[model samples]
Target: MLNQDVLRNARSPGRGFAAAKRGFDIAVALLALPAVLGVAAVLLLLNPIANRGPLFFVQARMGRNCKRFTIVKFRTMSAGQPEGGPAPRGPDDPVEDERITPLGRMLRRARIDELPQFFNVLSGDMSVIGPRPDVWDHAIHYLDSVPGYRARHTLRPGITGLAQVRGGYAEGIRATVQKTREDLAYIDGLSPRMELYILLRTVQVVFTGKGAR
Candidate 1:
């Protein structure tokens, strides 16, 4: 029998799963932070001219259930932008080609720009594996465009996830929409196995430097 209660409850947030995932997040972040921080230090030394003095960049991102939190990252672009910087384009457009400094390019390509987000995970603002967070502006735009976008918020935003594994920083609206569908799919089919798969695939991408940039 299809349990309506189960299906209905599934539509809501999974507090138990989230709590368990938080444990996983903390364990992984603790294990990975040393290496991540070491690399960040090296990058900061190499890219002192970029982003002025800041080695780490932090920004407000909408997290699980539309909660706002500061997400940390390695600085990748200059602090200032012209009046109208490069407009968002499709996945094929080179979004970083203009805004990214040479060092920034390497950071983005290596996915090191996102290392500091581990701190977010440790702080309970994010998860190890789930939908990625977005800025408020982009989150609002996407929720308006995508029907089930809010469903993803039932779980904490992840540093790496199904959408990210499938579409690392998609450049176009169409690609974003496609990635949105993949994120929703993940929400509907949440499980430890799936999470591990996404994490493993994400690691593969990072090592191969594929689908990143």
Candidate 2:
């Protein structure tokens, strides 16, 4: 069980950790730039022919300290279709929505759709490892309903994180609460070793498509 006091007393990463994290993010982003751009270029050309939509998807997400930032990704859904309102999806909905194009399914399974977020890390809007950012509207909902939820925002959101590696799609309030706990645990135990572990596990998740939705 999580200790409530630990959550309440959680501190942001130290200056050294913060500096190292940002430096690492920039270094990794630079190293991965060519591959990211190559994928984006291919997707841009193929998206028009295969998916018939914009190549990129951008949406507002809650960043550290509840700030809102635009998160970019490859567009995996049919163009112009509305994903219902801000309400969380129910259990009955498909893990990857039926609205996903066939190519989108492949992109998602490969976690390629999320490659665009490396720019967010490069820009300092996010980290390479931290709590996954929540959609703005859903962040509001979770803030109201989940205890210790806001504590996860003490650090910049991430492209991948401990909660993401441990928890799957948060379908409802219950699942959101569970994910919140995992996020809080990660935040409480932040360290270089743990960060490395999450990064490594993320590679496995991407390759195996574990808990991806």
Which candidate gets the maximum lDDT versus the true structure? 2
For residues 1-213, could you state the per-residue lDDT of candidate 1 as single tens digits?
223333344453377976777788899999989988798778767765555656776666679888788888887776664211232432234454566677777877888888888888889888888888866556666676655666668778889889888777764456666666777778777888898899789889999888876
Q: What is the lDDT of residue 157 in candidate 2?
A: 92
- How many backbone clashes does every candidate have? 4, 0
Candidate 2, number of clashes: 0
Worst 10 residues of 1 by lDDT: 82-91
Residue 88 CA displacement from its true place in model 2, Å: 10
TM-score of 1: 0.83
TM-score per candidate, chains pooled? 0.83, 0.92
lDDT of 2 at 7: 85
Regions of candidate 2 where Cα sits further than 4 Å from its true position: 82-96
How does candidate 2 score on lDDT? Answer: 0.81
Q: Which pairs in model 2 have colliding backbones?
A: none
Q: What is the lDDT of residue 78 in candidate 2?
A: 85
Write down the worst ten-residue block by lDDT for model 2.
84-93
